[model samples]
Target chain A: MRGAVIYAPGDVRFENLDDPKIINPTDAIIRTVATCVCGSDLWPYRGAEPIGDPHPMGHEYVGVVEEVGSEVANVRPGQFVVGSFATSDNSCANCLNGWQSSCLHREFMSTCQADYVRIPNAHGTLVATDEHPDAELVPSLLAVSDVMGTGWYAAVAAEVKPGSTAVVVGDGAVGLCGVIAAKELGAERIITMSRHESRQKLAREFGATDIIAERGDAGVARVKDLTGGIGADSVLECVGTSEAMRQALHSARPGGNVGFVGVPHEVAIDGEELFFSHVGLRGGPAPVRRHLPDLIDRVLTGRINPGKVFDLTLPLDQVAEGYRAMDERRAVKALLKP
Target chain B: MRGAVIYAPGDVRFENLDDPKIINPTDAIIRTVATCVCGSDLWPYRGAEPIGDPHPMGHEYVGVVEEVGSEVANVRPGQFVVGSFATSDNSCANCLNGWQSSCLHREFMSTCQADYVRIPNAHGTLVATDEHPDAELVPSLLAVSDVMGTGWYAAVAAEVKPGSTAVVVGDGAVGLCGVIAAKELGAERIITMSRHESRQKLAREFGATDIIAERGDAGVARVKDLTGGIGADSVLECVGTSEAMRQALHSARPGGNVGFVGVPHEVAIDGEELFFSHVGLRGGPAPVRRHLPDLIDRVLTGRINPGKVFDLTLPLDQVAEGYRAMDERRAVKALLKP
Candidate 1:
């Protein structure tokens, strides 16, 4: 099997690797039908995050089961399936509480950018479609494994409601998807912060009623101006930076919510400031496993087309170029076909 | 008029002060019926907060309306009233959104320990009782102005639901009141953290089903053990220190909520740690104004008796003793009488 491996900053290589095997009775091996480079992948690729010993990368996938361990019954050989970046047992206390990302026996997937990937807790994580849908629906289904699911979580966390105003910070793939989620969730007004023209266009297409190109204080001002001098009812922070967090917080009305999905870097929030803001905050790895079934249905029913986030596509062997294009802002997201 | 003035740390003195007068059309002058020393007062008394110059202190009171400005209509002269520490124009956007503490024209009361006090935004801030209540209910009515209202806000913010588990951090008046709130909100189990035997007894009386005297990590461990290893569904943080914030955050299960009411001193939360915890956090000065009528009704109906938190009573002129007892932890709270 071939997969993308990070050796150092800006040093991703496509290399042949030993195929993954089931290591637990709860595991299953899936032959990747579609995979993608995540914005989070850039953390290590750009040297923003430390890259220790070389390792396989990727956590999003829509694949077909090649084999299943004895205990895996929910998903079996030859079934097309979608799974979350974070695998869960589906029956743990946390999972029962709808926080599957925090399942006690959770394991995050990180080798899906290969021909074959071993999925832990497969019996609980993988949700097989009734039948393989049209080939064009694959990208959206793949997105449900992570970004689309994450975007949905952000909206849910922000408590977006019908007739309410929403602000989405970050123009990344997830943010664009968040615009879609907010719209689907009935947000009357969707405001997205984006400076990139292409991303802004997509955000608008996805139902962003307004766009603020400014960052930081200016961005907050624009949001407040649109939200009647207070702020939006919900702010989805799709970028994981201190500045983005600040903008999200400042863009929410008192008693409103800020749902942050981006993996925070060195962000430190002052308790006093947050306290005074009267904003509700909830963020984490999206409990994608909990929402996978519904999101998959949404995709299949043609209610939402999250596949539009993937502006560039590549053959799995050229995953390095996929990383480069996204890193350089040449593509919002790059879909890789194995 | 007489009032308590803080000339410096540990130096609260009873002094003759000018009688408060209506300075705004919406203002009302209330004759103090009952005012109490708060745990927050201990912050400045213990030199934890700066005291710039001698200033009138206290922000809790149940009083009789002595006079009202021309524009004041909700409550008339001689009417008994319950008011919040933070006054708000109820018609403001934030107030309409159920966040009166964050109202656009909010003013915090600070001279309520005096014989008379002027209330700004009186039309929206004061909730007048139908008639003067029995003497037995006066203390409880006073509690509704701040502590009880705050505790209710904490429970409401934490989203305490029927059959859920709730944890109250801090054993002060607000925390004890929080136990009452959780119970009223239908929490099946209420765990209160308290080292003081007296407070523990009071908490148990206030519907705290469990008491964990342990602090820090040990306390969190005990909470986890009692909550099936996941922590409580909701945690009400009634103390404002960094330690209290940490305990509150750690005591809530993933996807659980922490409603913090304490005015944080100097706390900083690491964004990454909070993100991974998957806990919802919302904290602020309680929107007591929003719940005043309901809380007053509860107090009058004998559904709750938060006034029991006041273990010491003193004449209004002996306000210095009120501060001293609370500062030394000799009393859970001190009630001041005019």
Candidate 2:
């Protein structure tokens, strides 16, 4: 199978790789139908996160179960399934508490940017639909594997409620999806910080009621100015930068909540600001597995169109181009067909 | 009137001052029955926090309402009242949202160590008992003004649910009060990290199920070991240092909550630790006014005896000794009678 591998900074190559096999009885072999390049992938692609060795890429995927291990009772071959970036044994204490991402037996799923990928803890990680989704639904279903689930987690963690105002920091795919998530959660006003015209358009399409192009403290000031100087009831931090985190924290009113889902990069928070802000902060690698079933239902029923985030699509062989497009901001997200 | 004033580091003087009088329609002048030195006062007393000039001391007090402003309809003259250190109108958006400490019309009450103190927004800041309480209840009620309320906020913010395991970082009076608060909230096991024998004793009496005489990483390891290596379900951070904050965050299981109530000194938090730990952090100046009704009832009924933390008592004229005792760690807390 040909998979995308990152050998070094700016050195992504598509080459033949050994096919995946069921290594654990709880694992399932998934023949990838759709996978994508995520904003997080850019961290290593841009050499922001150290890339020590040649590593197989991609974690998001929606695929057909080509083979299932004997222990995988819930999902079987020929089933269309969506899985999160990380696999977990759903029975663990953390999983039971709805933090499947931090499950006791958790493993990151890599090499999904190939023809076939092995999924560990298949029974807990994979959420299969009643039937195969239509071809057009692949991109949207793929999103549930990570981005959409992450956005949903952000809204849920922030306690975005009906009739409340929500602020989303970041203009990427996850941030756009957060607007949709907040809207689905019944937030009356969704404010997204985005300076880009195209992203702003999509943000509005995803139910954003307002947009502030400014960044940093100025952006927080803009959010406060819009919300009667009290800040939003809930702030979703989709970017992990220190500035974005600060903006998110500052953009929430006293007693409000800030839900951040972005993977942090060299971020340091001023504890004094957090202490005096009187705002609640909760985030992490989202428990996407917990929300997969509901998000899949929303996608299948046409209730939400989060797939619109994929502005570009490529064949699996063109995975390098897909990475470039997203890295250079040419594409919000790039969907890859295998 | 005589009040305790901080003239310089290690210099506290009890001297004559002008008697407080009602200046606003919402103000009420109270003849303090009982007042106490707080752990936070040591910040200025030790010169950790700047003391530019001789400043009136004390913010915690239980007193008789000697005079009520015309607009102070709820608290009447001659009524025994318990008030938070911060006075709020209780009519602003923040007050309505249960964050009276950050109310639009908020004012910090100072000079309460004096014979007479004027309380602004008396109707909102002061919670009057059904009838004047016995002298024994004054100390407990005085605690509600700050320390006890702060501890209660920590437990509440940490979401100390029934049957949960709670770990409290810091064994000061506030942290000790957190044990009591956790017990009141039905936490099955309350673990407090403490090394001082006296503090540990007070902590156990306040309902601590276990005491880890460890600090920093070792303290977190102890908490994790107690929780089967998963960490406590809730953690209350009563210390404002970075080390205490880190211990609180690391001691909580993924998806657990940490409620911090200490006035942060100079703390910087690593964002990655917070992001990856998946711990919920919420805190600030506690909304003591919000919890006053419930806490007052608990104290009045003898259900909780938080005032036992006051190990020393002194006459108002010896306010200097009261501050000295607390500063020297000779007394956990000092209660002063006017």
Best candidate, lDDT: 1
What's the lDDT for residue B207 in model 1?
Answer: 98
Sum up the clashes in candidate 1.
Answer: 0
- For TM-score, the strongest prediction is 1
Q: What lDDT tens digits, residue by residue, belong to model 1 across residues B1-338?
A: 88999988999998988989889999999999999999998899999999997898999999999999998999999999999999998999999999999999999999999899999999999999998999989999999889999999999989999999999999999999999999999999999999999999999999999999999999999999999999999999999999999999999999999999999999999999999999999999999998898889998899999999999999999988998888888999999999
Q: Model 1 segments beyond 4 Å from truth? A: none
The backbone clash count of each candidate, in order, is 0, 0
Per-residue alpha-carbon lDDT of candidate 1 for residues A69-144, written as tens digits (9 for 90 to 100): 9999998799999999999999999999999999999999998889999999999899999998799999999999
| TM-score of the second chain in candidate 2 | 0.98
lDDT of 1: 0.95
TM-score of each: 1.00, 0.98
Indicate the docking level reached by candidate 1.
Answer: high
DockQ computed for model 1 against the true two-chain complex using alpha carbons = 0.94
